[model samples]
Target: MHTSKLIKDTPTDRIFLFVLYIFIGLAVLIVLYPLIYIISASVSSPLAVNSGKMWLWPVGFNLDGYKVILQYGDIWRGYMMTIFYTISGTMVSLFITIPCAYAISRRDFAGKKWFTNFMLITMFLSGGLIPTYLLVRNLGMLNTVWAIIIPNAVSVYNIIVTKSFFQSTIPWEMQEAAKVDGASDFQIFFRIVLPLSAPIIAVMALFYGVGQWNDYFNSLVYLQNKNLYPLQMVLRQILVLQDMQQGSATGSTISQSAAQAAFSKEQLVAVIKYGVMIVSSLPVIMVYPLLQRYFVKGVLIGSLKG
Candidate 1:
């Protein structure tokens, strides 16, 4: 009887909960609406797309844009190159960051403080772009795939986050017990520490994977060979050229037929841009869900406790 009365008296709480859910629903819609519109516009005919006729659904369904973009062989090559870079770079980042973070997390290690300071300093300072470019040139990494992968192998922020997680979550008594059982430092770390640190590792993998997958600036700066270009650089080029082609060629002395042809080509290119985004980003986006399940737990567990 008391419980029933308490439940019945919670009208104010119910009202607040209803209002919170409504706000959350509205926020989700606001975030998802642009993505939905983009997907719809990509499939819609250029005439329907440009006239702002599209809403929640495609204005006129057409696959012409996708067909035109896929006809270009270089885009496929760029896709393959990007895949290689993202996978290889992520592996290198993990190799460098994991052990380094583990070492820093241990309080008793000699020179640990100095090492931590050195890493923190890097987070605050770097050789400017010109110096970095010169260094890459001197190393003969220019125009090669290595330029993109090697220079960014370890991110300082990621290292700090990883170290914090290890320190906060991993108990020292566990390490001592492993040592008592005749396990070497390497065995302790690999067999015990890493196996138990799945959440943080997943978080780091997602971070490194996303960074490598989306990287384009370094490729543009160092790589002169078009064959070595990542998907992002290729997409950027396509979008820029597409926009230029779209601008009015009316005042120019070009013939009427040429002007009309240019306009049509530009419209086609505009549609292709949206299609390219869908193609390039979809794979990376799909990977998020697998990693996302670990994100909240990883971040919460790994954060500094004191």
Candidate 2:
């Protein structure tokens, strides 16, 4: 028979905890409200959204926004394109980033300091837009699939994080042991290092995937074919075209039927914008939960080690 003693909080500790909870609760509300509002607005009727009647929850709940988005044909093509970009680009990034980070993290790797310093210089200084554009053009990457994929493949920050994770988390003794067993460096890396690197890999994948998914500037600058445009660019074009139509309608005289059609289109666009927001963010939100465990562990350990 053992009795467990309860520890009571002192007044100072209690007061500190109370204030801390309040601040934490406020922070949560600040972050959570926008997400809730976006969801609510996406479901609410266009009139309710535009009229400001929809606040914290849906007002005059409707699903036509989603219907209109579904009917929009280009969005599907853009989705396929975006998915391809995210998957392929992430693979390319991981392939380059992982090997480079591992090599740089190794103490025996020759000229590591020089290589790291050269890479670091890129973080602050770079050729201006014209020079970069010319370089890409000279390489004939412009207007090609590789235009976006190759140019933004390696992230220096990701490399640093992964390097720190490898240096601190992976034991140098383990590598030595593997080497003594008559395993070559390549074999040891392929067999041991990669297998234990899932957390950092997942974090890198999330970062690179999200960046590729949301990327539109590269498409705008380098891509010529409308068919090559990703989901973000497609959405932007839709919004721009709608605005143009509205401007034309307002500036020019139109018949009753035309006016009615324009007004109906306006309402559809209003709701569709919010629906698009939900649809665009849905993939990332779904992915985050899957990677949450790895993300937390990787970022924490990597950051702490650095």
Candidate 3:
């Protein structure tokens, strides 16, 4: 090993680096401020939140907002519904996307170019919402969980990313060796390709999971039944309508207590609103840490390949 002498940065270089760090610091603060404010508001006393006592940290810290939000039965039901939709939808999406991407990545596959063009065409062109809704209705999928999960299951964008990953990350030489050992196409894919494709799979799971979790528009359009409503829809109802149906359903004991709280009902509702937003988003937040290591690598490799 050779040791290299250190050269100090020139004054001009030092000045530029300092300026760059300052700019990056300001950008980070700009992004982090709102997130901190939301978390502070969610935990702060209703009066503290409404009076703007909350800043970077919570003032008059209390859990009343969370307590009130969690008291709702519908919130729990919505949680269950969203969990089911996220898991089931992600599994379905991965099943379709992974194989399709792998197949398209293989040079020997027939109609590869045509299939790629077809997927791209659908990506740019859609039948629009009206036709999509009509199609779902005609298929008798409307008002069911299938309407929410099935219509948008296979994302063309994901297919492209996964295909790029397979092409770049999985070596053709490995597949050839497997074939030489009398492995069929299916055996090679299952035994060899998939094992080497964990990074992309994790990335796809994160993408699909987050998309399905955050989705509410599909639920609103396709599912009229409140029982089938996902967390986002339920949160919307609570935030917008200030329904407090949960408290009322539990009887006047809870309702009277809520009314007797330190802050007025509307102010308290405002506090609960922030808590609901945080609660609704918590799952996706938790998921990010697990997939973050793979996300960048997967995206970079997948995008850079031919």
Q: Judged by TM-score, which candidate is best?
A: 3
For model 2, state the Cα shift of residue 50 in Å.
1.7
- State each model's CA lDDT, in order: 0.80, 0.83, 0.85
Candidate 1 lands at a TM-score of 0.85
| Model 3 deviation from the true structure expressed as Cα RMSD, one decimal place | 2.4
- Poorest lDDT segment (10 consecutive residues) of candidate 3: 248-257
Error of 1 at 22 (Å): 5.3
Model 1: lDDT equals 0.80
Tens digit per residue, CA lDDT, model 3, 178-237: 899999999999999989888888889888988999999999899989999999999898
Question: Candidate 2 on 1-306: residue-level lDDT in tens?
Answer: 999999999999999999999999999999999999989987887778888898899988877767656756678989999999999999999999999999999989999999999999999999988998899999999998899899899999899899998998899999999999999999988999999998889889988999999999999999988788899987777656653366543113222222444435556567667778888889889878877887777668666553
Write the number of the candidate with greater lDDT, choosing between 1 and 2: 2
Tell me the TM-score of model 3: 0.92
Comparing 2 and 3 by lDDT, which wins?
Answer: 3
Model 2 TM-score on a 0 to 1 scale? 0.88
Candidate 2 residue-wise lDDT at 82: 96
State the displacement of the C-alpha of residue 200, model 2, in Å, after optimal TM-score superposition.
Answer: 2.0
Residue 51 error, candidate 3, Å: 1.8
Clashing pairs in 2: none
